[model samples]
Target: MDLAQVKKLMLRHDGCVALKANTWSESTFTALQPLPVEQRGAYCVLKTVELVYLLCSVHPLPI
Candidate 1:
């Protein structure tokens, strides 16, 4: 999606957006890197993928 769509989606989803980076997919960073700072909304990079994998691997919660 284009930047406008991405921004709108994020706003619609309560400003919670998760961007994933891996060997297989186009990196979200690369796509947004060229945009001027003003166009880029607030965001943070987190270890969400690792944390999710770890959580699932251990099955910490009762299913």
Candidate 2:
């Protein structure tokens, strides 16, 4: 999906935001600064299929 579509989906989900981070970048951790404490919970991780499903649900495209 495109960045615009991804941003739209993220906005629709409450208290959730998406950040594009390189796996080896220290900025990845620094970029988490804006996320609210309550939303941060224990950790931030998601399964690949789960993420794909969410994106598809939000913006289904023609096959």
Candidate 3:
């Protein structure tokens, strides 16, 4: 998804704010390498992937 769509989805679910915080931390630290310049939305993408994995693991399928 594009950055705008990612932002909208995060805002809808309260994840946007946390993402902003993570971005800020990367900016403020000198030793910490900022997320790849190319992967501006990588964190959000990874988080969404993780959430999907968690849900699938915990939820049972209907027989």
Q: Give the winner by lDDT: 2 or 3.
A: 2
The residue pairs found clashing in candidate 3 are none
* Best model number under TM-score: 3
Q: Which of the two, 2 or 3, has more TM-score? A: 3
Structural similarity to truth (TM-score) of each candidate: 0.27, 0.26, 0.30
How many angstroms is residue 54 displaced in model 2 relative to the true structure, after the best TM-score fit? Answer: 6.3
TM-score of 1: 0.27
Best-first order by TM-score? 3, 1, 2
User: In terms of lDDT, which candidate is stronger, 1 or 2?
Assistant: 2
**Best by the lDDT measure:** 2
Cα lDDT of model 1 by residue, 1-63, tens digit: 144544565577687745455432344467557868865554213333443343345332121
Angstrom error at residue 60, model 3: 8.6
RMSD of each: 12.7, 11.9, 10.3
**RMSD versus native structure for model 3:** 10.3
Residue pairs clashing in model 2 are none
Q: Determine which window of 10 residues in candidate 2 has minimal summed lDDT.
A: 41-50
